[model samples]
Target: MATPDAPPTPATHPSADDVPIDKSTPDAEPPPELPENARARRYVILSFWLVVVLLGLPLWWKTTSIYRAPLPLRDMQSWADGRACRAEFPLLVEVEAPELSDPEHLIKSAQHALDDANDFSAHHLRLRLASPKLTDSTGNNAEENVAATLKLLPGPARSSHSYQLSNVSREIELFYSPSYNPSSSASSASLSLFVANTLQEIFAEEQQMISHLLSTSTPAPSSASGDSTSGSSKVNHAEIARKMSRILRYSPTYHLTFSLFTGSGTPTSWEIEDAIDEYLQPLLGALSGISNFTIDSQIQFYASPSDNVVPEWQPDGEPAEGEPQRGKWVLKKQDLSSFINSAEWPLASITSYPTINFIIYVPADELTPLSISGSATNAFLLPQWGGVKILNLPVEKIDGERKTHLTREDLKSSLDTFAGQLMSLLGAPAHPSSLPIRLDSLTRQRSAELLTSASSTLGSLYRLTLALPSISIPTSVSTAVSSTLESLQNACQELKQGRVGGEGGALAEGRNAAAQAERAFFEKSMVGQVYFPEEHKVAVYLPLMGPVGVPLVMSAVKELANFIKGWKASRVAKA
Candidate 1:
C-alpha cells in the first residue's frame, strides 16, 4: 500500500512545469599556455635543412656524377689547329751516274738549280752521289730509297740529249749528245742544266701532290684552290677531291680478289695464277713499302647479273622505234651500284684489311662489248669497292663458238686493266707516270691524311668529354686516350723534324697515332654510357621518398607557421 502510493506521487511531480532554461552566456576559455621550450622548435627545422644540404646533397652528387679523365685539352686543340707541327716532306735524291767523271760536282750544281727552280720549301729535295762500292752493294735496294737512278750513256751520233724512264724499274736512261759532257767542266757543267731541268719535270707532279697534302692537312688555305699563278707549284683541287672520293682509305694490308663471273658453264677455269704473277706481282711488290697485298682468284661459272639489273635506256638498234635489240644486254649508270651482290659474294680472306673485288664477267654467247652509262668504256671502276671488266668472246672464236678455257695470253688485256684499277683505287697519282714515283707520292699523302685524321679525332673526343659531363668513362677509355695523345705527340714531333726517311719516321708514327686515336674515339665502353634525365631519376626515387619526405616537409612548414605566430604574439606583448 505504501509503495503504490509513492509511485503515484513521483509521476505527478514534473508534470506541472518544465525546468527553467539558463539565458546567461559563458565566458570563452583562453588558449592553453605555450610550452616552455616551444622556441627551441626552430632548431629541429634547421637541423633537417642542415642534414639535407651537407650530407644528403653530397651523397646524391657522389652517386650521380660521371668520371671524366683529365685530358690535355690545350694540346689537342693545338694539334687540330695545325699549330703543334708544320708538316714537311724531305725527299732524298741519290744520283747514281757511273758515266760521269765528277758525279759529286755535277749533283751539287743540279741541286742548286733544283733549289732555285722550286719555291716550295716544305717539299725539300736533297741530292747525293752514290759511291761506286755503295752502288754495287745497293743494287735493287738503291732504287727503293732513291727517287730515280740516272744511267748516263753518251750517244755520239745523237744530236740532242734524251731521257727515258724504265717502266719496270726506277732507272732513267739518259742518252746525251757529245755536247752535254760533264767530264769537260768541273765548275759549270752544261749536262747539269739538262739534268736539272729533266729532274724538275719528273718531280713537278710529286711536288704538287706534296704541296696539296700539306696545305690540306694544315690550317693553311689549299694551294690547289688558290691562284696557280701566285705559286710555282699548282694542283687541281677538283681532280684531287674526285680521285680521293674514288680511292679507298689507307690500310696496312689489302685483300685483292680476282673473280671470274661467267654466264656460260663451258669456261669453268682460267690461268689466273700465271696472269697475276706476271702482270700484278711487280706492282704489288713496288707498293709493299706502303702496304702489303694478299691476292686470291676464283672462277664462278653459271653466274649472271642480279635480278635488280636495270635495262639500258634504249637498245643500240632501237633508236626510239620501240623495236627490241637482239642479243644486247648492258648495265646503266644507275645499275652500277647494285651490280655486285655483296650478300652472296665470298670473303677475300679473314683479315683486318678491306677486300677489293675485281671481277671479269664473261657472257654465255657473243654479247656486245659492255659499256658504261655515260661513256663507251669496256672497263668501269666502282668507288671504294673495285673494278669490273666485261669479257666478250673474240671475233674469231674457237670451233665457231666461244672458247671453253682462257689462257694467260687470252686474259692479258683484262688483267692489265685490273692492275691499273688497283693502282687507281690505291690512290696512286697519275702524273710522273712512273709507278715508283707515284707510289712514293701515295705514301706521303697517306701519311699526311693519317696525321690530320688522328689530330681531328683527338680534338673531337676532347670536345665530346666537355659537352657530356654525365657520361661515365671507364679506365680502359682513359688508357686508350692517353695512348692516343702520346702517339699523336710523337707523330707531330717527327713531322716537325721532317723525318720522312727509310721507314720508322713521321709516316709510320702518323699511322700508329691514327690507329690509336680511332680506337680510343670508338671505344665500346665510352659509347655505351646511356644518358638519364633528372625527371627520370626523380620518378625512380619517388616511391622510396614519398612516405618519408611528405611528413618531413609538413612538419617543417607547421613549425615555421607556429614560430611566426609566436613571434607576432611576443611583439604584441612588448608593445
Candidate 2:
C-alpha cells in the first residue's frame, strides 16, 4: 500500500495548474439562499451612516466648536484702518499779559506769532489769553497741561527771559518798552519775537515726537509706493524707532523695583524709600499723565552666574572687567541677560498686580571682581520690562550686619543710578524738555501703539477662526474682544480731545487693550485641538464595518444577478 501511494505520486505529480479548477462549487461549502428579510442588512448600514453623519456630526460639532464673541469686526477693522478715530491733540495753551492797548489785539498778535513759528502740524500750539485781574476760577488753571505761559510784565527793564522754573509759575516774562506795541496789526516788540521763538523752541521736541508717532502708526495709501515722502518717513523711522523702542508702552500702574545686588555682602538694605522720594517720586508723579506707578524694592543674596566665564579683550576694552569675577567664575557676554540666579533669588513675590520685578543681583563674595562676559555693554534694556545693574559691595562687617546686604546710606549713589535707568526704561521722550511734556508724549504713543496692537490681534483672531476648523472658541474670548475694542475706542477719544493727563488715562486704555488682546488671542481653548482624527474614527468602526459589510454585499450581489436573469427569461418567453 505504501509502494502504491508512492507510485501514485510518481504517476502524475500533478502541477498546481494540473489540479481541476472548482468553478461550479465553492471550495468548502456553497452559500445559502437569501433570507426573506435580508433587506434588513441595507437598513442596518443606512442607520449607521445616518447616525455618523447626523447625530454624531452634530454632537462632535457641539463639543468641539470654540466660543467666539461677536466682535464688531467692522468697527475693529475701521479702527485699524485709521477711520474709526482721528487723533488730534488740540492743546489749549493760554498766553497772558495784563498790560496792552487792546487785549483782543494783543491776543491776535501772539496767536499769529505762534502760528508763524510752529512747524509740526499735529502738535499745533494755540494761544488763549487770561485776564490780568483774574480770580481762582479764571486765573490760567495752572493744574491743566499748559505748555508754557508768556507773561508781559510791567518791567521798568529791557528784554524778555524765562524765569527760573523754581521761582515762578509762568515760563516766560517779557519786559515791554511801551514802543514794543503794534498799532494796526498789533505786531511789535523784540520781546514778542523772543517769546514766539522761545515758545516754538520749547515745543519743538514734542512736535517731532507727535509727528513721529503719527507717521509710524498711520497706514500708507495703497498706491503710495516708492514716493519720496514714504521713503523719507522710513528713514526718519529708522532713527525714531530706536528711541520709541527704548520707552515702555504706557501702563496704568508701573512697578518700580529697586534691588541691590553685589558680588559680596557689604551693602544690604538701601535707602530705597528715602532715595525714591528724593529722586524718583516727583518724576513718577509727573509721569502719572501717561501711567500710574507702584514702587517696590527687594534684595537678593548668594546670587551668581550659573556658568563659568572667560573674559576676552576687544579693540574697545576688556571683557566684563568690573565685578563679575567671583569664586574663579568668569562668564561670557552672551550669558548676561540670563545672568540672574533666578533659582535662588526671591525675584517672584507678589502673586499679581502687574508687578514688574526689577532685579538687583550681587554675586557671592568668593567671586570678587564681577564683569559681563564679553565686550562691554554693561547695561542692556529688556523691552517693556525692567533693568539690571551690577554694583560691587565692598566687603565690610557694618553695624553688626555680617554679610553684603545693601545699607540705606551705601545705596544712595546706587539709587540715583537706578532712578536714571528707570526713567530711560520708561521711555520718557527726550524733547518737550519738561518732565510733564515728555510724559504726555508717552501717553499718546502708548494709546496708539496699544490700539494698533489690539486691532491687529483681532484681525489675527478673525483669520484664525477662518483657518482652524477643529478649534473651539469660548464666550469669554468674545467678551474680551468686545471689551478691548471698547477700551481702544474710549482711549482714542481721550487722546484726540487732549483729555490725556499725568493721571494716565490714555495709557490706561492702551494697557487694557493690550491685556485684552493677549487674553483674546491666547484663550486656552483656541490652541491644542489634537486629540482625534478622522482616520482614527474610520479605524475604530472598521471591526463593525467588516462584519456588517458581508451580509449587505452578498444580498446586493444576489439581488442584482437575479434581477438580470429574470429579465432575460421574460424576454425569451416573449420571443
Best model per lDDT: 1
Model 2, span 1-575: residue lDDT tens: 35544434445588898899879985786675575554675566567667767887799779745555566667656665655655555566666666665656666666687766554444566677764444233234544555445666655556334432212233555555644655633335455565666666655555555566655654411111223222223135566677677666555576666666554444555567876787667767666656667776766544555544333433333447564432324456567656656666566646334555455556555554455555253444555566675554555646766553345565555555565566677665555445545555556556656666676676677667666655667788878888888887777767656666534466577678778978988887665543445576678768866886686567667767866987899999999
TM-score per candidate, in order? 0.77, 0.68
- Model 1 lDDT-worst window of ten: 220-229
In candidate 1, how many Å is residue 484 off?
A: 2.9
Cα error, candidate 1, residue 288 (Å) = 3.7
What global local distance difference test value does model 1 have? 0.71
| Reference-based lDDT, residue 391, model 2 | 53
- Tens digits of per-residue lDDT for model 1 on 536-570? 76888899779868977998889878879989999
Candidate 2, residue 525: how far the Cα is off, in Å? 1.4
